[model samples]
Target: MQTQSVQKNNVHKKSRSSLSVYLGQWNAPVVGYVFIAPWLIGFLVLQLWPIIQSFYLSFTEYSLLDAPHWIGSANYENIAKDRLFFNSLKVTFTYVLASVPLKLAAALFIAILLNRSIRGISVYRTLIYLPSLIGGSMAVAVLWRNIFGTDGFINNLVVLFGFTPHNWIGMPETALSTLIILSAWQFGSSMIIFLAGLKQIPSELYEASSVDGAGPVRKFISVTLPMLSPVILFNLIMGIINSFQMFTQAFIVTEGKPYNSTEVYALFLYKKAFGSLEMGYASALAWILLIIIGIMTLLNFIASKYWVFYESESGASK
Candidate 1:
């Protein structure tokens, strides 16, 4: 009886060990997929599905109340003659052209200032980044509206300086400028990215340049700019994309006021999608915007080959 019981126990242990080994083999192959299942499902359901639907709907007339009807390229044809479409595109292009460069410049400048090794620098960075955290909020938009209003804080400051208080948001010429200024002010994200890039730059390069009697301006031009070009390209593309899609501030603060001077493309798309219920037209616009962004990004990549220097490429070439 003892011999039989001991053999039974050994068999049980062997079975358990074999089972565990099989499970380990299976888990090794499937664990990564299990972890990524949520993201994959989300992409398929929330993003890829919507993108496909939008592309299909862009070719059809899909009012919310009725079934989508096939319309071929009529929407695109109509867009060709749509004055507001042109206006919104013009405003968006102008905003992208102006705001992106300004924002990147400001971010780079602040990053350079903040990159020093000093006490409480993190606190300073946090304080500066705070605005960007709340920058897109409705409250911030309202606050910005008040600041640029005729009798708001900015006007008070102008009065103190003996300059006449002007309605910044109410004017066509200056309305977009205020939005651009706000965009530039929310440069904290770009600044952080620039700081990261700056940290990655080899100090040996700077030392070598310094030893060669390079001045501050010379070192920056020779050493800093070349190494930082990739970061600049990244920031530039992101800035262009964000600036082109700017809507909340324009919607809440200016409402594309003073003869639609500040009417950005996204705001126009919003009006078409929700306001007029022209879902098909809006989808077409969205796709067109996507195409425009893709082209711009492609152009940036083409242009980058001329200016963007990679350390790996340099090493490989040498």
Candidate 2:
């Protein structure tokens, strides 16, 4: 009886040790999965699922009121002849090309000015960044519309300067330009990013360039630009992406008015999806936009080989 009891005790101890080993091996992974589960689930449901559905829906006619009818490639074929599609694409390209450079230039300029060591610098940054905080809101867009209206502040200010009052957002020729100007005005985010990049740059490089009799422009060209190239690449890609996806300001301010002059790709997509309820067609447009953005990003990266300097690759020849 004693021998049997001792064998049972040994078996119990062995089982407990095995159980502990298993738990120990899985503990970290289990915790990690638990932590990531929320984000993973949200992404799968909100983002990934919608993407897959949109791709599938692109091949079918799906109105909210009815079932999705399989009409393979019809939507894409229609898109080939869609005049509005072409027009919106043109407007979007113009906005992206024009606004991005202007925005980057403004951001870099402000960043340089703010990078100075002086009293109340933090306050200045806060004040400057304040515009970006409200830039994308509906209220801001409404305010912008009011500001550029016929009897608006802009016209009033111009009238005071002995100029004829013109409606900025009323005319087709100037409508898209107003949106572009608004885009450039909201450069605070990019400015902040540029400022951060400037902060990371080594003062030693500037001092060395100064010792070599390099003036401000020469140092900026040689030392500042080379060091800031990576940051520029990052900002440029982000600006392009954001500009391509711009909708809120255009929607609230212009609503693609004055002969669809400000009809950007996103606004057009929204109109197709919701206004006309051409779900399938809108889905195709969305996919095409994704492809375009992807191609542009790839091209940027490919071109960046010549311009985007990395500190880690300093020893490598261009």
Residue-level lDDT tens digits of model 2 in 1-318: 999999999999999999999878887978798899999999999999999999999999998899999999999999999999999999999999999999999999999999999999999999999999999999999999999999999999999999999978989989999999999999999999999999999999999989999999999999889999999999999999999999999999999988999999999999999999999999999999999999999999999999888988876753
Worst 10 residues of 1 by lDDT: 22-31
Q: What's the CA RMSD of model 1 in angstroms?
A: 2.1
Error of 1 at 314 (Å): 0.5
lDDT of the candidates, in the order given: 0.94, 0.95
Residue 9 of model 1, lDDT score: 100
Kindly give the number of clashing pairs for every candidate.
0, 0
Give the alpha carbon lDDT tens digit for every residue of 1-318 in model 1.
999999999999999999989878886548788889999899999999999999988999998999999999999998889999999999999999989999999999999999999999999999988999998889999999998899999999999999998989988979999999999999999999999999999999999999999999998999999999999999999888888889999999999988999999999999999999999999999999999999999999999999999999999999
Candidate 2 accuracy as TM-score: 0.92
TM-score of each: 0.94, 0.92
| Candidate 2: residue pairs that collide | none
